[model samples]
Target: MDALTRRSFICGGAALAAMATMPAVAATGVKTLKNGKTTVDLVANKVLAQVGGVLELTIKKYGKVAVVRTSKGVKGFSVINLACPHAFVTVKRSGNGWVCSPPGHGSEFLLNGKLKVPPATTDLKAIKFTANSKLLTID
Candidate 1:
């Protein structure tokens, strides 16, 4: 696997591990649709920012993929998770895109999850986006 994939694997493992301690219901599988799409409100989801936009959503038991911009007009959007690859920190948007917490400064990322500097080289996991008149799919 490439360095970026390795990072994702490691971090993804950590995320799974963290979820292990939660209640079974928290980890229980939901209506995970392969061809279904749902809209997530960043503000309601508690992943919003002043300038940054959310890219995807995970229904815990469901699978995951990176969120991408579908169109180029008013409906255009981008999706991303808030987890940090370095130390599993719950990152946030510092200025425009992303910034890690715990007082260890200088860790920033582009809105798309590219490393802005050191300590984090892997970009955020992006999901697939498929849209049409009948449906908008995220898988």
Candidate 2:
């Protein structure tokens, strides 16, 4: 093997740092109802216990979606589609929000799916949902 060069070492370190900063996508348990709605048990999804936590999951009705904890109440959450409105490309989590990746034109959205930057004029599509003390049901 070749000896490690200063340039290679610096580049490697930078790459590792980038990877470390990338957001981790967590999958939450889901239940599909006979009425075609989807349900998530709030207690089972520990992440939502804290504000700003997010759970990513695939729904039959909405390709990819994220359920975000916005505050501390039954109404303090948001469920949004992951597809970028610009090109229908899937946006990935970056920093405290989402960034439209390549194959897309670099739109950005807040964690709650609010539009931050454009190429995309709208926020991520919000899916109708209702929450109780123990469950969140997506309509």
Clashes of each: 7, 0
TM-score of every prediction relative to native: 0.48, 0.83
Write one digit per residue (lDDT tens) for candidate 2, span 40-127: 9898889889998999898998999999999999999999999998879888776678877655666779999999988799999999
RMSD of each: 10.2, 7.0
Flag regions of model 1 displaced more than 4 Å: 1-58, 61-76, 103-106, 133-135
Tens-digit lDDT track for model 1 on 1-139?
A: 2234555455445545554553321211123455455544323332223223344445453333334343343245455566776756666544445656443333567766778866777875555544443233444
Residue pairs of candidate 2 with colliding backbone atoms: none
How many clashing residue pairs are found in candidate 2?
0
